[model samples]
Target: MHNDCAECPADSPDDKVFAVFWETQSNCQNLVGNPHTRFLTHIMWSFVEPGEDGTVPSEFQYWSQEHIKDCILQLRMYEICIHDVYTLKCDVVVVVAYVRFGFDGIDIDDETGNMKGTHQDWLTHHGPVVVNYLQALRDGLDAIQRPDEPRYLLTWDEFPSAWDPPDPTNEHYTGCISFHEDYDGWHRCYEPRISALVDMVNVMFYNIDSGDWVYELVLKDTLPVKAAAVIPKNKIVVGACSGQGCVSDQPIGQEVYNAGNGSAFYRGSNVR
Candidate 1:
């Protein structure tokens, strides 16, 4: 006698699992339209086993060890694709690690033998390989540069908190730092060690729940102001979110005094 499992099926059906492709295009008809700016493309990859009803699997459940490895391998391949696109278009390539939960260990029978651990551990184990690959890609571009053109590598989410210097002799070879308000805690956590290694700090100012209030009260009035008084301003780069659903009415430059119904005032330029 065989018992049927409510979740897992004996064999995944071909019709049940399929990949979908999507593309977005915008018409540049106004001053806001800039052809030079490339759309920051985000490619999210995930693995799913087919369900009994022939639908894609949900993200709520834990993925198996093999599944996790396969996903990472796919992401590595996707990174190569990004390199190819970047080489052709001169557009920025940002590889985002969208995995939300833990990952299984590659060495399942290692000395410690603990299978369940945070994704960071797996990332730590495999990060060097990915970084080296990126470095080689960057070097290839640099070899053919016309001196007037500039290129850069941008990565997010999957960026590791700690790693050995890519080049021990070259301090500038240390990775760049990009920040998100959501990951402010991670920033603080890695600040002591990685701060020295960082070349530029890309401060993500978008998606903040509270606009000028948080920027003024939390960041400018508090952390950044204090940090600036102690550190260097050249280290930071402020960014804004101009995508749909983002509030564009908020003042950016010295005019931010008009942010909160002409009450609260910010006395600085947007860039600084």
Candidate 2:
């Protein structure tokens, strides 16, 4: 979702997303007097590092479960649903607390892709086992449905399509490393199959200058992956950033919207 930055150019009328990332270390007090508070639809809670044993270690220094509950209750005033996603590691056990804490969804973000062990391990071995983990997480979220409440979301912080190297001969030039031509392992992690399992593949764009570069990255790299039908265009959400890690050289939210053919723009900036 777009923020109320005057220096940042506005998004198109059709681009209707105003999401933000809320760091777990921050408290609800920070939301007070926030100008962009009125426009947010989603707020993803950041960095719940999980262990390989499928549990969030109590030793971790982020907010306690009760604190998260209080924060969620306070955030409801703005009508924004919180995606309490775990970062660094993936754990299915913590999915049970999703409804208990009034969470709207689960976002799995393991940048190293080493949830199972080793980089790219989960994606590479996402077969029936990984599928079952996703299914179990989905089922846990769905089992608590109340008809009146919005459906729970299951999204992944996916590798950006533009992350592929520039050289034509590079093996990873195709963007989706799981679907690379030379690969001979399991292919269930292939885009289309995994896309069906989650609500959205939230592309994580990091350290890139905003404006035309963001647009061109989506247009040239991201769209091509969709064109190949690896990942559905509709299921993709182009991530825009404007925080410490991101380089907001210029604002071009509308360019990202246009480049993605009017797909939702997920503002993944660390605006806390």
Candidate 3:
């Protein structure tokens, strides 16, 4: 889902009321409870970074720790839904970053709209910053965790390739999730890049009114299947539509099952 600090003001009166409700339900009796208790962590592996002529500079970056902390505090204070229940189990924190790729410049007919290119062409042109970001974030997360510590879940929202105008067709679009081809390219590029670093991979399967086939294809046709074909089943998490606008309406367990295709695909697999 989306995270909007403005709509859900963490320090607002409404947020305070919900925060109290959340603390009660989460059994957070101690004020000094672990910060992890208040957050469901997801490591964000891609972000929108400004680029020049399809080339990303080495300087630009994603949100920093202070910014993230502010976002989290706001999330706890105003934006999160206390009655939603998912938050109670700390099922929402995600660490987000970006990858960069640069491609040989080419021109296409804006009028004809004929598309032709290999996935490799697009990926190399776009730059591999997203893949690199995933690798770094995974390492950072791993370095931070203790041996016995339960790992915080990791997720990646596929980077958008094109900017869509605001219109009826774009109502369901956030200019975020795109086509399966681009997603496949990302998976192919990223799977091997971060294979050893990450414990799981969650791909965004929602944007507008898309159906389950796309999600199924991602699992059956992409990462999960491919990973199994190579190594053992890799941990793959899917992002399904759960009716909640900014957050998921389902509980954490239900969301996990939804991501796992009703517990059929990843069932008995190590990726979960």
Candidate 4:
């Protein structure tokens, strides 16, 4: 959604870096005038936990549940949804989401070339588990979406694709989002095959707290580059954190970048 930056720059007046602010620590008043508010193209109300053990994860959480009813009431008070989405502009911002969970350290069985006996049973079959999970979400959203209205959104944060593959020579079977030989040397979980269901994926590039200065990680072309290597740049957003122990140089990417403060998520300078 576009914001009214009346005197914004001519070349890139609407440059966006999607940011996440916790609902617990922030409110409408806290955000409206924040310095970083202007830079936000999308605001992900974050860390919304899903039902911890469901086959098809449910978006209900005891801690964050009240906000749904309360937010609808707030919308009623503001009378925002009376207008259709196309006409509403940014007057009413809404979102429905599923945070990516339990996606890590998948072992490809040597014989079968799979992660045996799990939802992500194999290298490539992992796609259907995610595709179906997301398609279910899409159907739910489509059911509620008003005619011609912009969808609120169904998005998630994905694990970084790779974690130092054992065989970088062939770059085979790197877990998480890495380039694997199984799917023709692309991210097993993040293929274009699921693009129809997923709207967006946030790649966390920082929190390399155990490593060197974040500047070394970002400006020098490391994690962020790895993230884009396997995932489509258009469907991805880069996230960063303020480096407490380390600093970084400039960054370069086609994806939207948003780095938050130490307390917030994502911290880094803008990359044009």
The top-ranked prediction according to TM-score is 2
Can you give the lDDT of residue 197 in candidate 2? 77
Better of 1 and 4 by TM-score: 4
Model 3 C-alpha lDDT per residue in residues 222-272, reported as the tens digit of each score:
545554443234344444443342132333343445544623553121111
Rank list by lDDT: 2, 4, 3, 1
- TM-score for predicted model 3 compared with the true structure: 0.36
**1-272 per-residue lDDT for model 1 (tens digits):** 01211332232111111111111222212211322112212222222333434343333134343443343354333231111111011112222121222221000001110012212232343334334534444454345444653333222211122222233355443321222332332221122322232323333343344456655653444334543442244433333333342334443542333122111222111111
Error of 4 at 51 (Å): 3.0
lDDT of 2 by residue, 16-116 (tens): 44456665465576663465575555576665666667776643246665665576666555444334443324534455564445566777764433233
Model 4: per-residue lDDT, tens digit, 95-134? 2322222111111111112333322333465545555655
Worst 10 residues of 3 by lDDT: 103-112
- Total clashes in model 4, counting residue pairs 3 or more apart in sequence or in different chains: 14
For the record, the alpha-carbon RMSD of candidate 3 to the native fold, in angstroms, is: 15.1
What TM-score, computed on C-alpha atoms, does each candidate reach?
0.32, 0.66, 0.36, 0.50
- Give all candidate RMSDs, comma-separated: 19.6, 7.6, 15.1, 11.1
The models' CA-based lDDT, in order, is 0.27, 0.51, 0.31, 0.36
